[model samples]
Target: MTARHVLLLGPLLMLLGAAYLLPFLGVMRWSVTLPEPGFGQYHAALSDPLVLGVIWRTVRICAVVTVIAVAAAYALTLIWVRGGRTARTLVELCIMIPFWISVLTRAFGWLALLSNKGIINGWLQSLGFLSEPLTLVRNEFGVVVGMVHFLIPFAAFPLATAMRSVDERVLLAARGMGASRTRIFWQIFLPMTKNGVLGAALLVFVFALGFFVTPAILGGGRSVMVAELIYLRIFQSPDWGLGAAISVILMVTVGLLLGVMMRQNRGAAR
Candidate 1:
């Protein structure tokens, strides 16, 4: 609040403004000023069937990824909270190993494993499980698998925190009262971790919305999401105005989701 405090914070604020704010402003400027100005680009992006379809697919795929990732995370969190040291170490390794790997590398790894002639199909064919390989890569299924693999760690951390915060005495008391494991889990444990699960879902959903590399590499241009579409519009097709318009729209959508997440956090705190 003092002048000295303001002076100390000024440099950091200026650095953020220069690094992040300015480029964002430039994108916002291009969205409206290019192609003779106005909001025509926004109208065009929204009205284009291809654009709409890409946006719809992005939302749908992200939603599915979030659901699966959160469920898997919940199970992992349970193991993390209740298991022995070896089990916990294994779970930690599983989550953190992929977390450290590059996104592009992970995508290509999935591509190799899921492609038509990939390991899974090869194994199946060798075992006489099928006459032909199943289509996995270059489609929605591959995209979802790649994304869910990427997002599980993101979902796990929050759920683990929530699970750790749960009171052990409450669970013990329920068990002493002859409440079944299933009944206690459904009635008590799940409700306590509801906020964490919701928070993880929203977080994963937002990240998945803007995913570019995984979808692009795995989808193989066959399944285009909004981010990939934006790249294609800007670099491949040379449509800066439309690309910027879509970028701005994507930014706004992410902002809205973050806002909802913050609101939920506040409600959970109370």
Candidate 2:
């Protein structure tokens, strides 16, 4: 890069850093010093079982969502890359269309599909598959479903971008060299796209960690996540201190995960 490029990029980097850092600094101050002083809020955040449980639930749900989204995205990307023009266009449209719709609307749609008297249960009952509703909505299962729906597109977009860059001739050559389909994918395609998959997984997991509306609407009060917990602390309890503490913890958790991901990527590159 030229000196002129560095000069132009310096201010942009500083601006971006300030944008991200200022709010976090404020949160850190508030978390430690609000509602009196010292690290009381942090202590509360760490010690409270309810708070810990919510954090754990958020991590667990996000992990599941990330796994499902990444796996499904990789499979879909393979199809999209190998497919004919018409098929590729159709699948790409299907994957991208969800992003245009509101998350709330999508959550509502899932509600309709998973509710006790909704389409799924109604269909199951009609077919004598079950005598009653299968307890799909208003639970962990509902939360995961809604999260997966929202995250799948995010995972797919990146994986598709990566897959598009893969060399078709190389894959064909591997097959010509008497490599099995599974062997070719595991040894060649998977290694080539590993970075993108990891990047997408981290992206999806972080976004899922901070998710609010879907869990609120679908999980109801039963399965609370950290974001919902933060909301309650800020508005319902009028405890800005605790809210800030939770926010700081959440941000730090994401930062640590992101740092780990970066290190792994660097190691992989090396």
Candidate 3:
């Protein structure tokens, strides 16, 4: 509430507000009153079977990715917190490395690893385990794997920070009281970190919902996310109104989830 703080934040807030609101307003107008005008696009976007399927697929994939990423991150954070310095540093480096790498590069790396002539298939073939290459790339499995790899770091960093905030003395006291490790974890650790877990899950879910590059590269047209569909509608079909409608839907859905998360976080703090 200082004058200096207000002066610095005022212009920045204005710029951010304009940046978000302008395009959003444009999209909203197009969604409700474009092409023929007056809600036709929105109605079609809601009632069309293809659109509904794409939306459902996007939600389903995001849910699966969120579950896998959050579960893995929780276990990894526990290990990282308890690990030696060297091990924790190595894990941290592994997580950071992916974040710095380009999504296209990561997708290509996954293709190289999962393709028929890739290392995994070669190893299996060498071991006489399979007569043919397994289908890993260009499918739901590949999409999930690549998405999880990208999202795991986002999930881990937040949860790890939350875990570190927990008082070690509290855990020690639980142990001294003859509580089992599982009981201590369930009763103490999980409840304390619930907010962090919820926040990470929301973050990962939103990111996964809007994911385009990895799914496009790895899915190979087999798995179609809503983002990809929007891209196709705009650039391929040149149906700007339909594409705008889809974009509006995505923005609204993510915005509502974020609003709920913020409310829940505020309640937790109180």
Per-model TM against the reference: 0.96, 0.89, 0.94
- The 10-residue segment of model 3 with minimum total lDDT is 30-39
lDDT of 1 by residue, 185-264 (tens): 99999999999999999999999999999999999998899999999999999999999999999999999999999999
Most accurate candidate by lDDT: 1
In Å, residue 126's CA in model 3 sits off its true spot by 2.3
Compute the lDDT of residue 222 as modeled in candidate 2.
88
Measured on C-alpha atoms, candidate 3 has an lDDT of 0.90
What lDDT does the true structure give each of the candidates? Answer: 0.94, 0.90, 0.90
lDDT of 2 by residue, 16-76 (tens): 8799888789888989889888999999999999898888888899999999989988887
Clashing pairs in 2: none
Instruction: Please report how far candidate 1 places residue 44 from its true position, in Å.
Output: 1.1
Per-residue CA lDDT of candidate 3, range 42-156, in tens? 8899999999998998899999999999999888887788789988888778777887898889998998999889989999999999999999988888999999999999999
Off by over 4 Å in 1: 1-9
